[model samples]
Target: MIALPFLKSVAPPLQGKRIYLRPPTLSDYRAWASLRAESREFLAPWEPLWAVDDLERGAFRHRIRHYDDEAAAGTAHPFFLFRNTDQRLLGGITLGNIRRGVGQNGMIGYWIGAPFAGQGFMHEALSLLIPYAFTKVRLHRLEAACIPSNERSIRLLEKAGFQREGLLRSYLKINGMWQDHLLFALIEDDARAGK
Candidate 1:
């Protein structure tokens, strides 16, 4: 396992008032696929184009394996957000492209099931995740990018204390098309200031 230089010990599951985040497992395929299938239309606009077998169990298993590999390499941390009350899978979050040494930073991305949208679940999950990234993961900065039309995501990022940095032209491909995105960032000092 490639341990993070700043991480002296194993980190615990990130817990919040309404949700908890844990690494995805093979056993989570059924629930994950079901939620993604149900939320396909809701998520499509903000996500990458899905392959024909995206929701297949085999594909999901492969995703889990990839996540595990990334985590072990200390390049990313992928988590499934679950409701604490019922243990329902609400969404997924990833802090990817982690950089150490002089640049202690990572990029954050997330999605929520359609049924769970408009709830405060994601907010709570992010609250827990930000602190973990800053403290346990020792990230000095966390970045997020959202499509220009994604108002909800923009608001969520702002509410979580991220500052709108700039806009990137054709920054990423979403649903098979290159899309412009608004960049946002939060630094460790910003969190310390309670922003």
Candidate 2:
């Protein structure tokens, strides 16, 4: 008989009041695709354009594969937000492009399904993810950028205790264009200090 070694996991799923963040699963496609298809108009403005066949079954499977690869490499931790009690998929959140060593930081990004928008689910998700990043992952800071025109997102970031740093000129290629962005940051101490 041959013995196999088991590998230990580094991170765990995070939970909040209304929602919990979990790794994306193959079973999520049906619910996820419905939200994306129904909210095409709502999400299009802030999101990159989807190809005509983007959400087809094959494409989504490929997307999940890519997300898995990034997660394994420590480049990102991507989660599909779900209602806590029911575990219904709400949307996705990510702590991406993580940098360790001297920086010890990562960028935050998220999008809520249209039906779940304005219900404060994203706020709940961020509340859980940020603290997890700080204490569990041992990151020093979390950073986010919002298109200047995204008033709702700005408000959400502020509610999560992220402070406006400055405007970054042509900072990111967003929705197919190089657009200016407002930088926001939240250090662990700032969150701990209740700022």
Candidate 3:
């Protein structure tokens, strides 16, 4: 069996050409809230409903604490995606529910702020992030599920080399009701071969 403590100790942070991935900080609260509030319209369809209080800095601090604990425990790695040149917070990316032993896998989740969508920053981040997950983390596979209607997200994942595995009937409760998601995955060997 793979050792959990070793994975926790060696969890890697990924940096991309345009974005740098880092652990969340309290200082990021205002920027995070501002981005979410401004992008509500753009992101609401894919995300869970947000309470009015969710936009407050205190709420964001709570979220940071949760993410920090998950990352430290090796259960997840939640990174704030930032523009490397300007250091502007663009959005967030996370690899969560990381499993070892017989699974050797993890699930990926991410979002880009409203203003930054379609700018190709996420594509760059994922391109770098996936390799780090596979090679450095030594995971056998990475998985992601996207609402079928999210054309942009589907395209982004495809561009980053994930293959469509199948559809999960009402796989997730998103934005309130159950929603179907197209499951996608990339095996480490396939990714290494540029497939």
Per-prediction TM-score to the true structure, in the order listed: 0.95, 0.91, 0.93
Instruction: Predict model 2's lDDT versus the native.
Output: 0.86
List model 1 lDDT by residue over 1-195, tens digit each.
764466432336888888999988899989999999999999999999999999998899889888878887777888899999999999999889988879989999999999999898888888989998998888999999999899999999999999999999999999999999999999999998998
- Per-residue lDDT of candidate 3, residues 24-71 (tens digit): 789988888888888988998998788779988778888888887887
Clashing pairs in 3: none
RMSD to native, candidate 1: 1.9
Sorted on lDDT, best first, the list reads: 1, 2, 3
Q: List per-prediction Cα lDDT, in the order shown.
A: 0.90, 0.86, 0.85
lDDT of 1: 0.90
Model 2 is weakest, by summed lDDT over 10 consecutive residues, at 2-11
Model 1 residue 125 CA deviation (Å) reads 0.9
Candidate 3: 10-residue stretch with minimal lDDT: 4-13
Error of 3 at 190 (Å): 0.6
Q: Please give the lDDT score for candidate 3.
A: 0.85
* Pairs that collide, model 2: none
